[model samples]
Structures are given as structure tokens and as C-alpha cells.
Target: MNQGKTKKIVYKTVLHIVLIILSVTMLVPFLWMISSSLKTTQEMFASPPTWIPRYVAWENYTYMLQAAPWMRYFGNTFFISALTIAGQLITCSMAAYAFARLRFKGRNLIFLIYLGTMMIPFQVVMIPQFKIVKILGLVNTHWSLIVPGIFNAFGTFLLRQFFQTIPKELEEAAKIDGCGYPRIFWEIVIKNSKPAIITLVVFTFMNTWNDFQRPLIFLNDDSLWTLSMGLAKFQGTYVTQWNQMMAGALITMVPVLVLYIFAQKYFVQGIVMSGLKE
Candidate 1:
């Protein structure tokens, strides 16, 4: 027993050391971004890359805000992300329920088709997707982002897997109490899938908020540009403005970081629950 305890302690010490190293590796870039954001333009490229600036140049953030229509970018990003999340939650949940609980013909075949779409690289579909958006007059509109994300095969598959693991008895009990399909789905299935939903919300928010390619292709007007697109322009125009770029980067990351801090518990729970088999 004593030997086993000693071995466990040794293992834990090694694990902690490894984790600390990995954490530092991941944190260094973020630290540099923040540190450089507070440094003068000259200090940003100073030899050895100063980890700390001699003076905290807070005006970099102000300069960035004034340099571009950052407030417009923020509004556009928030609008697009919110719409994407709302649409995905409603559509994916309904589709997942249909796959998980309802009996229908060609269910597995349809699901397989959906899964197959995931295998196809986004590049292959980019041109066709753009053409469709153009034809539909959704180009340069928020709908370009909101509509395409509404039907996510991955989100449907994920929620379906979770929904399938729920006990049939709970659903049957609801049915016996005169609950209809919609009522049972909302109360029994959805309530129990809170963690999974929160996971989807976080994922959808992050992806839509940071997405650049689609927006770049669709939104031509600067006024309609999201934060990601704006940042790309910021970097391209002011390549030497490292401080301003870092400030923009830091500002863009704030919402995601705040969200993760609050929803981290559900994120972990969702990951664990997703792995369970019925």
C-alpha cells in the first residue's frame, strides 16, 4: 500500500509538471498579445520581444476604436452570432428529436447522407454555396450567415446521440399522461439536454463570431462587416500598427472568454454526457 501511494504521488507530480508546461505554451501567445497591445509600436518588435512593456499604452485601444467602425463590427457580429445560435437550437433540436425518438422511413439512410456531407471539405462547396446565396439575394445580408448555419448536421448528430441515451420509460410516461410529441419533446427531452444545448450554443457562438471567410465572400460593404472581417482589414491596412492590431484581437476575444468562464461547467458536462451510450 505504501509503495502504491508513493508511485501515485510520483505520477501526479509528473502529470502536474507536464500540464504546467502545456499551459505555459498555450498562454504565451495570449500573454504576448495583451502585453504588446499595451506597448508602443517600437516596443512591439524590440529585441527578444519584450514580455512586459516599459509603459502601458492604453491609447492603442482607443486608437483602434477610432481607426475603424469597430462598434458596427461588434453589432454585426453579435447579431449574426445570436441569429445563428437561435436557429441552430431550434432546427437541430427538432431534427435530433425526429432522429432519436420518432419512427420514420429511411431514417438511418438520411442520417448517413447527413454524415456524408460532413466528410466533404468546405472548399468543395464554397463556390456552390456562394452562388446559391447570390441567387437568393442573401449576399451582403446577415441571412447569408444565419441561414447556412441553421441546418448543421454535426449539431443534429450530437444532440441525437445524447437524446437516444435518455430512458424510453421517461418518454413513455409522458405519453401515458396524455402528452403529445411536441409537449413531451419540449419538457422531457429538451429539459434533460440543457448541458448539450449549452455546449451547442457555445460552439455556435464561437464559430460564427470568429468566422471570416463566409462573411468576406458575402458582405462587401464595410458597414455590414463583422468583427473578424474588420480585424482582417485592420491588420492589412495597418501592418505596422502591431499595438492596435493586438488591441483589436484582445477586444474580439473578450466575449468568447467571458462566455466560456460562465458556461464552462455545462461545457464539461456536455462533453461527458455526449460519450455515454444507451
Candidate 2:
């Protein structure tokens, strides 16, 4: 008994040490980003990378705002992310529910086709997508970004898997009570699938928020540029302004970080729940 207790203690101690090391490794880059953002130009390029800046130059942030259309970028990013998430949630949830519970013709074959698209690289289709967007007169508009993301194959697949795990007895009970499909879906399935929905929201927000390629390809006007695109331009124009660049980068990450912190619990729970057998 004593030997077994000692072995368990040693195992826990080793596990704790490994976790601590991994945590520090993950945090180092972010800590460096924040530290460099607050440093002066000279301090940023000092012989050894400074773990902490000698002086915290708050002016770096103010200067970044003055140097670019930061406010416009922020607004554009928020608008795109909000619209994309709204469309994705509605469309993906409905599709997922139908695929999971409802019987329809060629259902498996249609789902297989949808899954097949996921294997196709985005690069292979970008030129074609651009041509289609231009033909629709949405090339320079936010609709270009919003429209493509609305019918996401991955979101549908994820939610379908989660919905399949839900007990059919609940749906049967709702049916007996004279509840329609929409009513049952909204009140029963969606309520129980909060974790999965939150997971989708977090993913959609992060992807749309940080995306640069789509904005660069679709938006030609500077005023319509998202934060990621604006930041890329800022980096190129102010190559020497490491401080300001870091500040802008940090500002860009704020919304995503805040969202992750809030939704992290549901994100983890959803992942675990999705993997378990019903």
C-alpha cells in the first residue's frame, strides 16, 4: 500500500512539472508581444530580446491609432464577423438537425458530397470563387466574406455529430405534445446543444476575425479593409515601427482573446461531449 501511494505521488509530481513547462512555452510569445508593444524602438531591437521593457511607452498605442484607419478597420471586422456568425449558426444548425434526425432522399450521398468538399484545398478554388464574387458584384463588398462562410461544411458536420447523440425520446415526447419540427428544434435540440453552438460561435468569430486573405482578395478599397488587412498595410508602411506594429497586433487580438476566455468552458465541454457515445 505504501509503495503504491509513493508511485502515485511521483506520477502526479511529474505530470504537474510537464504541465507547468507547457504552459510557460505557450505563454512566452504572448508575453513577448505585450512587452515589445510597450517598448521604445531602440528597446525592441536591443542585443538580447528584453523579457520586460525598460520603459512602458503607452504612446506606441496612441501613435498606431493616428497612423492608420484603426477605427474603420475595427468596425469592418466586427460587422463581418457578426454577419458571418449569424448566417452560419442559422444555416449550419438547420442543416445539421435535418441530417441528424430527419429522413430525406439521397441524404447519405448528399452528406458525402458535402464532406468531400472539405478535402478540397481552399487555394484550388480561390480563383473560381473570386470570379463568382465579381460576377455577383460583391467583390469589393463585405458580402463577399459573409456569403462564402454561411454554408460551412465543417460546422454542419460538427453540429450533426452532436445532434445525433441526443436521445430520440425527447423528440418523440415533443411530437406527442403536438410540437412542430421548428418548435422542437429551437426549444429542445438547441437548448441542449448550447455547448456545441458556443463552440461554433467561438470558431467562426476567430476565423473571420483573423482572416486576411479573403479581405485582401475581395476588398480593393482601403476604407473597407478589415483589421487584419489594415494591420498588414501598417506593418509594411511602418517597417521600423516595431513598437507600433506590436501595439496594433495586440489591439487586433483583444476581441478574440476576450471571446475565447468567455467561451473556453463551453468549448472544452463541447469537444468532450461530441466524442462520447450516447
Candidate 3:
């Protein structure tokens, strides 16, 4: 091979080696979580540490299930996540559509102010938000969780950016066919925005499903606790059950993992498309 070709080969090989090392580093925690879940408490703390349990403790899963109302937590989380996803998709998309397609006064200013809300940390608004929820009589109810999450500044910004990329010709044509704003939105915008919609769905679902703080503040009822809250039961003041916690954590990860797996293709596309502008 020529010197240039040899140099390219060496560079590519070194790049691959570095990537492999980084990939393995990122995977270590996940792999260890799986391994720890299958181990007994004693085995988990064994000298030199064991990557694979000598004896797989299937009882860890059973113990985890018996320790808490995991099935109910799962149901509550799924229900909350579903409603949040639906609400965000509808509300954010409409807001985005208006900002993207419709001409109105102060549109850019309004959008900028709305987007500025994203910079405010949730901690700053936690107390006021709870008070508002209480005033609306939604405190200690699922609505408290679902309502606040439904309208997100980030989601609006994401969808708006994506909506701006759609060809104006499509909307104009739809109007020529006697389609009103609603019909055009449904047929022209939403129908063609699957990638962005699914991307938002995955984002909203993951956020709602993994949320711990909001539920912690709003939901005082044990029956309404999410998996993140339920996992706290594995932790004791004096001694934490490492194995059971790992098992419960693994269980909690299943839904998020399944969601990302199915939406993996559209998720990437949506993110990329949302960043593009006409």
C-alpha cells in the first residue's frame, strides 16, 4: 500500500479502538447492574468482586415484587406517561403550528418568552407549582402530575423548529382544496411529522416515566407512587438492600428500554430534522 493509504488505515484502526473503549466504559454500569441483580447480598460484596454470580438468585426478583406494589406502580406510571404524552403532543404541536405557520402579532416575541421558560430550573418553581396545583384542587391526584407536564416549553420549541421545515407549498395546496386550518394541520402537518411526533413521544414518555421529584411532591398517596418512588422502598435508613434495589432498578428500566428500542429510528430522524430550518 502507498504511504497515504497506510496512514488512513492506521488512523481508522486507532479511531475504532478508542470508540470501542468508550462504548465498553459506558456499558460497564449497566452490565454491573444486571450482574448485581442476580447475586446474593454476600456474593455482591465478595472479595475481589464477581462480575458473574456463582449462583443466580432468582429469588431477588420475587423478593423485589413482594416488597412493593410494583405492578400498581407500573400501571400508574404507564397511565400518567400516556396522558402526558398525548397532552404534550396536542398542546405543544398546536402552539408550534401557530408559531410556525400562522401570522399573528408578537409571534416571535411570544415564542421567545415561552422558550425562555426552559431556562428556569424546576426547583425554583416547585413550591409555587404545588400551590397552584393545590388551588386547582389537583394536589395529591394524578392530574397534578399530568397537567403540569403536558405543556412543556422545550417540546413546543422542538416541534416548532420541525414544523418550520415543512414546505409551505403543502399548506397552500391544502387551503386551495377548501381545507381549513384544522384539516390542514391534521392532514398536511401531523401526517407528515411522524418522526418529530414520535420523537416527542419518546422524550415525553421517558421524562414522565422516570420522573421522581414531581411525583414525590404531588402524590402523597402510596397507591399512586411511580416506579421511581417505589424503588425507594428498597432503601433502608440503616442498611440498604443492594441486590433488591438493583433488581427493582432493572425492572424500572424495562419500559424505557422498550420504548427507545421501538422509537430508535424515528427518534434520531426527529432530532436531526427538528434542528433544520428553511
Candidate 4:
């Protein structure tokens, strides 16, 4: 028994060591980015790249801020991301409810077709989506980004799986108490599905926030450009501002990081529970 206990202890210790190593490995790039953001161009490219900058270039951030209309870029990004999250929550939840609960003809077939859309890469649909948006005269507008991102197949699938795991007895009781489908959905299913909802919100926010290609294709005006677009153009025709670029990149990551930190518990729970139903 003592030998068996020792073996289990060794196994657990080894597992923890492996996980710590993997965590540090993944953090290396992020750590480097932070280091680079604080360094001058020369120090950033020094022969032996220093993790600690000899001379911290605080001006890099200030320069990056002055270099672009970051306020407008942030406003545009937030506007688009907020609307996309709202629209996805409403549309995806409704669709997922119908798919998970309602008995309708061709539901499974329709769901399968909808799920198949996830397999299609964004690159494949870019041209056609661009043409459609152009025809709608939404080119050079934020709506071009918001409208395309409003409904997501993965969000619907995730919510539907979570909704299915909800006990039907609570819904039945609500029905017997004269509660309608809308009431039951709002009070029962939605209230219990917080983790899944938060998970979808995080995913939608991250995708919309980081999305570069869609905005690039649809928006022609500089004022409509997002952080991604703004950062891409930070490079000069003759010179690349590596330090300033790294600073901007670091700042760009803050929103997503804060969001994940807050929603991490729910996100992990949602991912685990959603898979259990399938």
C-alpha cells in the first residue's frame, strides 16, 4: 500500500511538472511581446535579445497613440463587437431552442446543413460575402462587419447542446403553471444556461474583436478601420516601427484578456458540459 501511494504521488508530481512546462512554453511569445513593447528598436534587435530592456521606451506607447486615431478604431471595434454579441445571443439562442426542444419537420436535416457551414472556411465565402455586402451598399460601413457576424453556427450548436441538458421537468412545471414557451425559455432555460451563454459571449467577442479580413474587405475608408487594420498600416513605407507596433499589439490584446479572465470559469464549464450531451 505504501509503495502504491508513492507511485501515485510520483505520477501526480510528474503530471504537474509537465503542465507547468507547457504553460511557460505557451507564455513565452506573450512575455516576449511585452518585453519588446518596452524596448527601443535597437534594443529590440540587439544581438542577444534581452528579456529586460536596458532602456525602456515609454514613448512607444505614447507614439503609437498619437500615430493613429485609436479612439475611433476602438469605438468602431466595440460597436461592431457589441452588436454582434447581442444579435448572436438573440438569434442563436432562439434557433438553438427550436433545434433542441421543438418538434418540427426536417429539423435535424436543417441543423446538419447549418452545422456543415462551420466546415467551410471564411476564405471560401469572402468573395461572395463581399459582393453581397457591396450590393447592399454597406461597403465602408460597420454594419458590414456586424451583420455577417450576428449569427454563428458554432454558437447555436453550443447553446443547443447545453439547452438539451436542461431538465424537462422544470419546463413542464412552468407549462402547467400556465407559463408560455417564451416565459419558460427566459426564466428556466436561459437562467440555467449562464455558463453556455457566457462562453458564447466570450467566443463572439474575441472573434469580432480580432477580425481583420472582414473589416479589410468591406471597409474602404480609413475612419472605419479597426485596431487590426490600424496596426497593419502602422508600418511606414520605408521603415517598420517594431517597438511601437509591439506596443499597439500588446494594447490590442487587453480587452480579450480581461474578458477571458472574467469568464474563464464559465467558459471551461460550458465547454465541458456541452460535450457531455453529445
Estimate every model's Cα lDDT from 0 to 1.
Answer: 0.88, 0.88, 0.88, 0.87
lDDT of candidate 2 over 1-278, digit per residue (tens): 99999999999999999999999999988988899899998888898788878888999999888889899999999999999999999999999999999998999899889878888998999999999999998999999999997888888888898899999999999999999999999998999998788888877788899998989898989999999999998777766677788899999999988977888876676456445423
Ranking by TM-score: 3, 1, 2, 4
How does model 4 score by TM-score? Answer: 0.90
RMSD of each: 2.4, 2.5, 2.1, 2.3
Tell me each candidate's TM-score.
Answer: 0.91, 0.91, 0.93, 0.90
Model 1 Cα shift for residue 25 (angstroms): 1.8
Model 3 C-alpha lDDT per residue in residues 138-242, reported as the tens digit of each score? 999899999988998878878888888999999998888999999999999999988788888888887889898889899998898899987774464316778
Off by over 4 Å in 2: 1-7, 269-278
lDDT of each residue in 1-278, candidate 4, tens digit only: 99999999999999999999999999998998899999988897798789999998999999888878888898889999999999999999999999998888999999999988988999999999999988998878999988888989888999998899999999999999999889988999999998789888887888889988888788988898898887776664316777888888987888888877888886676567556534
Tens digits of per-residue lDDT, candidate 1, 20-132, equal: 99999999999989998999888887898788799889999999889999999999999999999999999999999999989989988987888678789888988999999
